[model samples]
Target chain A: MTTPTTGLPPEPAGRRSWLRDHSELGVCVMLLVLGALVLTDALTMDVDLTQRGPVGPRTVPVVVGAGLLVVAVLLAVDVVRGGRGRAETGEDVDLSEPADWRTVLLLTGVFLGSAVLIEPLGFPVSGALLFWGAAFALGSRRFDRDPLIAATVSLVAHTVFDNLLGVPLPGGPLMGVL
Target chain B: MNALTSLLDGFGTALTPINLLWAAIGVLLGTAIGVLPGIGPAMAVALLLPVTYGLEPIGAFIMFAGIYYGAMFGGSTTSILLNTPGESAAVVAAMEGNPMAKSGRGAQALAAAAIGHFAGGMVGTVLLVALAPAVAGLAVDIGAPDYFAIMVLAFIAVTSVLGSSRIRGLASLLIGLTIGLVGLDRMTGQQRLTFGSLQLADGIDVVIVAVGLFAIGEALWVAAHLRRGPPEPIPVGLPWLSRGDVRRTWKSWARGPFIGFPFGAIPAGGAEIPTFLSYVTEKRLSRHQEEWGKGAIEGVAGPESAASASAAGTLVTMLTLGLPTTAVAAVMLAAFQQYGIQPGPLLFEREPDLVWGLIASLFVGMVLLLALNLPLAPVWAKLLRIPRPYLYAGILFFASIGAYAVGGEVIDLVILLIIGLIGFGMRRYGLPVLPAIVAVILGPAAEQQLRRALQISDGSVSGLVGTPFSVTVYAVIVLLLAWPLLKKAVTRRRAEH
Candidate 1:
């Protein structure tokens, strides 16, 4: 039978190994790791007599840690029982297409690159690169138009946010040149 | 009568030229972004939240009220023409409106939706004006225990009511709670998960969590599966209803608010259920049974009204109890907290101008929406033709600006990217993002309330259930948890018969 709830195409029975089928196990593992980290942190935390109530700072974290562990186990059980989650759908999302990892990776790299360079290169130069990089990653190939638009977008953002809105942004080598 | 006078005074405040200008700008920007595929009202508000940093609290909230309502109004345009819902609440509108568009009645469908939205929004705001004060009046007596119980109910309700799997929902919530656990504990000032970072001591900013999750996460997710080529929007002439169309839709519009407003006021009672209920109710009452699945005006009319009305209803809970039942409400609540304005019973007395003006501005926003957007439908529809690359790139660009603008530090941007990845993972794994956001917003508050409750009773658990209100809330929570089992048992019994 087709998985109506999950909106996934029906899988061939016994064609793939069970391990491959249960890719969601990764999520469970992540949850378990997080739970352990929280538990370790909460357990090791020092509590002086500053706490007035029986429910001190550690209580909520401990409870939350236990909850994460419980939820991880429960989710693992559900996944093994042939349950599947329906990936989120949106207006731009095409569920029929396999995820484009290259684009996601490129976008991530661009984002991180901007974050690293924002302070040193300033918002205008870095942000312009960020916009162009993201557009290229998303498949905009108009080399002539894209950079022009990106530079314009970055400058406009700088002007509005820095000058108009009065929220300061670093200008770097081009400081006061604009 | 008191609410009426207060509302009138609110109108006086909202009508000031500066406040009106902000409202108009909010409506314009909100609708423009809301019309874009993959961006909903919540994302619009979250992306715009940082820009309001320089404004006073009153203007910011007034603008938010405009944005909130304006986005809902804009969502239907995309739903009707593009056959893609801007948000979950607009799904019902797309069901019939898309069919109507396919049948070459796109304008009629849009007219019905727009007018129906106006009618429902008006009713919901009136009810909000009337009911919010009464609810807040009663809420004044609610102790920390009762508040804690309500928060628990909200958490459980959001988890249980949404998504197919309870395990995934709970897991998402736990992740949010863990994130919320970072920073110095409210009571003892001891770090729970800060890991000795100076920035972590103050905790992750709600602006980061909000923009990172809603805006940046959405941008990344869309980038991964970006649809090739521009969407083909159904062309429509100016939206104008004939006499027959209005005659058909007015009844549904009238009936929709009654169905939508009460549902909106309740905790975790989002627009989805009420809109669905309105659609079903209209289908049942209509004489055109054959058109049930086809392009039915009543179908669009009812659900559109319900959705708008529920938006107002969601605000009721947000204003009266400081509880947010929908994603948009949650982000708006964060916006309130950003300004150090705690919305609840006391807000009515403390910030009457801000509160009342915000409520009155909802009406002003509706007028602006109908007056401007009705003729501007084609302009909004054209927004869909913008290439997916620039749309998503703009989102990331603005998100980065918003995040960095918050603290003027690179660390905030790093945190933003990390949260964006988690958000992307949540979507990939079919985890509902709403619970996570609500948890992030309410987690620390709920923990504080829980501790205070226990402290009042000297660490006895009975303090949690001491009040009748809290006790009743606990009973509801129990019922919410047991519902799935109850439903399964009923189905099995029926099968045996």
Candidate 2:
């Protein structure tokens, strides 16, 4: 599909970086790694001597592992043949613009930070931080209003989910207050 | 008559004040969340699924019935007012309804949609009441091998029929299958992919996967490409149809469920095709043929009914066969699992009240939706104007709470983040998320069925295709997988001629 131009040199502006052009190869790589992991795990599993069925635990995993490997190879071939996966589009999505990695990374950091802090800080504090940080990450800049709203949202969620709903959430330092 | 008696009893349970309150709350919350610009019915349900976890099973399911209908109505509301479809099913709604909204006929469009929804849902539920029992009875005779074959057929259908790239879809399925394999083998105590972690032994919660993939993944995806500036929701008064509007749309509403339910009842039959079918049928049969592209009310009426009808159809498949053909149905199936209820042939016999009550509430929900939403169309439209930051932040916030609250473990949060990243990657690469979700929910069951079939045949491979039903299902699977290649060859042959 990429027929070379013999007379004129390839235009740099028209060309994308190889990684960007073949970003789907990353999915292929991930699939391959997953396939290998599944296969290794299945092959190493200990089967009891008194197994009743020929279709033991390893059978499905082996088939699924092989399927993953086969699909990874097929996807790679399709990618090399100039077939491209379509980026998902939605109402808010502007695919014409490149993905904003900064927001995604910031949100990821906030999520992980909350996960780490939830046990120590309790949901009210950590959940508020999560909501506020996520809002900030998504470009909400009102420090006063955002924190207040975040706290309200967090407290309500904590109260409803923990106090009312009976999902046990660690209260951290606020263990005795409420 | 027997079905009627069962349905009456179901109403007895669903009509209680407590259950009715849950239904009302589900409808309100489902519509509120679903009215958000980017959230679809599936995501709305997934995000709210945790809330119902603490409730008793019957009340929760009644709530689910309301949420299901409410989210769908909300999706159409968004499609009409903002021309922003939350899911593929609503794309047809946006087609004629958005144009209607643009022309200052937004109220009529909403009226047509709401009424159409009520009509379609009523017909679909009636048919479900009539047919689901018979289907479940027939399903009782299906052997393990046949069941496995059907699962295989489902996998093939979702991967091949729904997505543009079959390979990508298959890859997504494999990813889900791998995730499904994380827990200990049910028969043996051996772990398949637990990696020695205690949390992994229980396997990743379907709620975590669903919320991560649909809610968090979507939030992150939208955040990365947040449409700057607020969405201009079309201003509208109460949704009210004229006599002529009703006369024109009533037949289309009748026609839509007949078209939608059968498609939804079949394995791998989704709402998308039926919606398009209804729109085209309405166009071909309409007196106002030229008005189709120019915002004809029939276009809104037919497809909205069809989408609603298909939702009912999806429930039929889910309840009778334990097969979920759409993302929302899959999540609902997961909800059943969360309640330790396996929705299959035995479900009708095992949980009559739960099943009948859920079915009964569908009828009740339709009435409630029409009554509540028709007067509140303008209010629902206002929900579209919420700031993108706060809207998406709330999604992540609730998503965190839901995931964490599932097992109440910090590890679930970590797993949620990982799944969320994978989901982000999936959207970036254009892989369909539905197939992965369906695979995750059904993969373990499929494996168990295959093993059971094989065990019965004493390790013989022929055991997989031992039954007539299994044979037929395998044949369909072959045809489905080969369909694209066959199409390519036929086109090439035509060119040669």
Candidate 3:
């Protein structure tokens, strides 16, 4: 991605260089947008004449939003001056390897799918499917044993939650037993 | 004498057959979960919080006390048996503990670690019993201005002490404060930032934030970096120490709690600092100088005791001042909120029986951890062999349940998913997750106190620094903010020279 000076004329390049160096400019932009939003929201609140005080609900929001803008500016300058936090390196795994994007994308799908299906399908059915789908996402191929375990886990969770703990879980088709 | 009588009565509550059974189960499960490859005690506590949702507060807290200490005891076992430490504090343990394991002294290392935990937990709990009431008394005298000042202090400490850069930490905190603003304004019943959405009018739930940040976020991050295969597990047996080993560890255990307690009692205290400090203390003071870097039994013993003692010390501020210094404490604060209980000075006056009972149970839970972990060390180590696919999938399943069970809204699941993805990005970018969660829980509280202080002074700006206590606190905050910049400049000058 670096070493890309080939495609452009290089006269007024300091501006581009500053932006490029400040890669965390995106976070700065986000902060400014959020600050604007908070200001917008705080200004739009209905004026309650009956409730007058030294401070009101809007005071803290305004202070925090303005603080964020100042922090964003400082952070951007720091980035341009070559300050950056290092990536996490754990003792357990090989961080040298690029992240397995395939597995990550699949797990994202599984979580999203479960969120959509959970209410309609109920806890037991959605829970089992979530279990099985996540296992697949993480590279499990034991089709026979995985399904059986997922079923047992989901059903047992249903029983323990609904019956034992007294926190009611949705029972779906097996509502009678669960 | 009154405190003693109440504590004894607390024992009567904790010693009941049903509560004892729950304590046993809590410690046992705490160890099992804590032994997972990457999961720490904080993550374990956060994940398992929902299980006690339906129980009465007394029994639920009895179980939580066990889970809290049990998980800490269990963290060291994983460090000794596995290359990766589950908790940051246990990283020091793995230094000496793993070597001891490889050298066929795994049993000895486990014994030292377990016994160290017992000593630390006992002493720490004793101090808690004595100091908590005194601290609560002091806290009662503090007014709204002081309370707001301390909350601001906590906010600064939490953000500045965590993550790589202060700016990122502040950013995460701002995001949390924005989220906190979504609900109806408590005083005037005015909606702040709900954007006409009724679901948001109640504000975001802390449980969803916790589950997303710790459980689902961690699971997804691990999956994204899924290792080619499972880590090779080190086999071990029941923990037992040699005579000489026992003699070696006794002094270290005695010293560890003294070093650990004050650190954990401070706001924004982290478990990692105390453990590392313990390791260095032992290294400097050890008789066996040859074993400094290798498998020094003192290394395992000192850090483990400090780690446990600090865990107990964290509870002091949490229960008395309603300030949480660690990630697990923040989540536990959310748990108290779930029960409609606010832990502060009034907590002692309003619910003495419950408070005493919870403290008494910590002692019981410590004993239970020692009894269960020594014989079951081998059994818990075997849990490390569970396939990654099934393990993480199961985590997601449980995390989803935790979110859905809270108010039973599908929209909560959507919040969890979005927050989980953001958590993933936070992890990837080295933006710590703890600050965000802490800010979310404490943001509303700080604002409430701020307004109360202001109302008392009729909107005078100087009202915030009204009391000498608040003045001192603000001075400390200014010092804290300035120290980092001054240090940076000193280093730069030194480098130039």
Candidate 4:
């Protein structure tokens, strides 16, 4: 999908080529779909006719929905008008690198794990696990050191918040033991 | 004289061992975050907001102030070392400082930036001390319509002037406004966009949105297009700026504050414009044109100074007018509200110590920042060598911790992830983040004022435009909107020759 290089002077396009070539069409379609969904939601919203005065519950949504639709239309128009910058039309940056995926997956896992474990594991252990897991995800191969770092981060954070600051953090299963 | 005595009294309050410790901790944390690429003071403040909930109000504020200025100082470190600017204001510094680093003058660039930051920060603090009370006096006269007008002006300036395209900027801002509307309608207590979910009732925390968009979203975007390349270590040299280099940069450093402060005071626009303006002005004024874009010391000094100065200027407005000119300022305002102290004209009369002590601490912060940045340039540069995977992972970990800690709500974590996804998408599509941030912070306030104005005028549209002050404010907004097109046209006309 790469455009042939013309003899024309290169434009000051930085990262726009990604949008110009591969993503603009998809982005345009997505915008239209999002706009349509929002518009539909906004339309179906029950207008509180009972409220007196100029603005009701539906007023702001209708305005915002219409605005979104208008912007979506404008964006589609810009794509059609060939105003897509060079960054959009250029070759996509490679995403196959392990470092990138590892980071992303690690973060995703950390968030997911934090959600699952926060109640059972408690704030201190869960927070430490989350922290250490994330650090590991960022490619920290220091197996021996990771746990220490994580535990320390979680423990110190707990002490500061729970003990010193007096904010109640969950004690988890260790409620009585700790 | 009375003010000076009161300020002295504030120093007495701020200089306490507890307050001093908090300030130091805040600066240390602020510097660490600021040195990281892509993170800035706004995110730093947001991340720390939950943690600060337990501290006494004065100590919390002292630490917050330290973070604000400390982040500014730290932002310059990244801009000078790597081309990756931690804050929008430091973007200009990166343009020249990166080149300097590449040319093996990394140490000189660091020295110039640190010194420039100190000078600009000092000037901004002095201005804050002198002008805040007067500005607060004027703020007392502002009615709802006036507040509405000012917010409108801020929205227009930020969304229209920021980023490469006005359309995209406005779009980003609209998204933020929409997000801001997710919670209950404050006026009527009616559900706006909760979609029947109880978790969405209180609305998404601004911190969740910020962390998601900035920290998580940024990490995701970076990861998705990771280049498998060996990290380049920036070579370090002598930390001190030579006599000749200092002589050249001194003028730019002096000029930078004036360039930065006015822009900072102007609501909505970020530090980017002023720093860019300062760089251009320095280039035009300089005798050594050949040095520019090729590691010019003035290039490093001017923009760095302007960034810090503008940061100070933003603080003035936040404290006095309760108006946030930038994202960082907006977050700071949120922090103030969290402390149960609403900043405005009444703030001076009500909480003189908090306001003045905060102002006095800026001067103290500049000294601490300089000492840390100047002698420790190499140490800061070592931060860049941190493996990307590890760095980003650390950010995510802390982000979740911060988000969860904010209210201890499990739903906040969900909000963080969703916002992070939005942020990632925006960055992937080249949509600017700051406009959305500024809009989110100002959106509810703007809507509140607009509704109040409408209510006051008995729902007359013209009543919204009735006051002279409102008219003036709208006029300024219109002028700002039209200026870019006018400038572009003028530039094109010149090129036609």
Error of 2 at B156 (Å): 0.8
Question: Which model, 2 or 4, shows the larger lDDT?
Answer: 2
Candidate 4 docking DockQ: 0.29
Question: What is the lDDT of every predicted structure here?
Answer: 0.88, 0.87, 0.82, 0.75
Question: What digit string (tens of lDDT, one per residue) describes model 2 on residues B1-497?
Answer: 38899999999998999988888888887787778788888888898778766889998888877888898889889889888787888889999999999998999999999999899999999999989999899888898898899888888898889878888889999998998899888878788799899889988999999999999889998888887775688899999989999999999999999988988887554678998999999999999887889899999999888878888889988998899899888898889999889999989999999999999988888889888998878889888888788888888989998898897899999999899899989998878898899999999999989888889999899999888888999999999988989999999999999
TM-score of 4: 0.89
Model 4, range A101-142, lDDT digits (tens) per residue? 556766787778887788888877887787777767656678
Over 4 Å off, model 1: A1-17
Compose the digit string of candidate 4's lDDT tens values, residues B295-353. 88899898888888888888877788787888777777767766768777889889988
Q: Kindly report which residue pairs in candidate 2 clash with one another.
A: none
Q: Pick by lDDT: which candidate is best? A: 1
Candidate 1 on B359-395: residue-level lDDT in tens?
Answer: 9999998888788888998898888788888889989
Most DockQ-accurate candidate: 1
Once fitted onto the true fold, the runs of candidate 4 whose alpha carbons sit more than 4 angstroms away are A1-22, A25-52, A84-106, A174-176, B1-5, B95-105, B227-230, B235-238, B488-497
Q: By how many angstroms RMSD does model 2 differ from the true structure?
A: 2.3
Model 3: interface root-mean-square deviation in Å: 3.4
Error of 4 at B210 (Å): 1.9
lDDT of 2: 0.87
lDDT of 3 by residue, A1-178 (tens): 0112333433575777656545567777777888888888888777567355867878888887887788778766765556664444443445668778898888888877877886677788888998999999888999989988998899889888878887767776656454
